[model samples]
Target: MIMCREATKLMSLKLDRPLTRREQLQLRLHTLMCSACRRCESQFELLHGLGDKLPDTDDTSSRS
Candidate 1:
């Protein structure tokens, strides 16, 4: 089983950029055995994508 720390680190790395082949293999192995971590990873990926799709607002006039 992948420890929480390692899973968290992998999660962060995934958010930063595409994983190397070794990293991808490791993540796959970890997820295959750890359903909880897999779910967490999926949630993080969904939330990250959602954040990216959100529009940025610089104008404050609407609030006035």
Candidate 2:
């Protein structure tokens, strides 16, 4: 079973890139058995979704 530390790392990495099948399975299993991690995973997804809807902050071109 993946520990909380590794599980959390995987969770963060998931936001940045696609996880491998093994990593996805491990995180899924960990979240299933750990309620705290499950909640965290939900929160991470929520934040990621919200971030996607936010406007980009790159205004350097506009400044000129």
Candidate 3:
């Protein structure tokens, strides 16, 4: 079983790209047994999605 820290790390990486075979298996195993970590992972995904929707400030001009 993967530890909480390891699982969280892998979950973060998954935000950018699909996890490797080993990482996928580890995360599955870890989440199956750890509810807290799973919740944390879910929250991370939600926050990541919200961030994606935010507009970039650099694209906006301040002239008025």
Judged by lDDT, which candidate is best? 2
Clashing pairs for predicted structure model 1, backbone only: none
lDDT of 1 at 32: 86
lDDT of 1 by residue, 1-64 (tens): 4576787698889899998888878888888888888899999999999999999877886686
Output the lDDT of residue 57, model 3.
Answer: 81
Error of model 1, residue 25, in angstroms: 1.0
Superior candidate under TM-score, 1 versus 3: 3
Q: What is the alpha-carbon lDDT for the whole of candidate 2?
A: 0.95
Which candidate, 1 or 2, would have the higher TM-score against the true structure?
Answer: 2
Put down candidate 2 lDDT per residue, 1-64, tens digits, no spaces: 9999999999999999999999999999999899999999889999999999999897887795
lDDT of 3 by residue, 1-64 (tens): 7789999999999999999999999999999999999899989999999999998786357655
Report the error of model 2 at residue 61, Å: 8.6
lDDT of each: 0.85, 0.95, 0.92
Local distance difference test, candidate 3? 0.92
* Candidate 2, run of 10 with poorest lDDT: 55-64
Collision pairs in model 3 = none
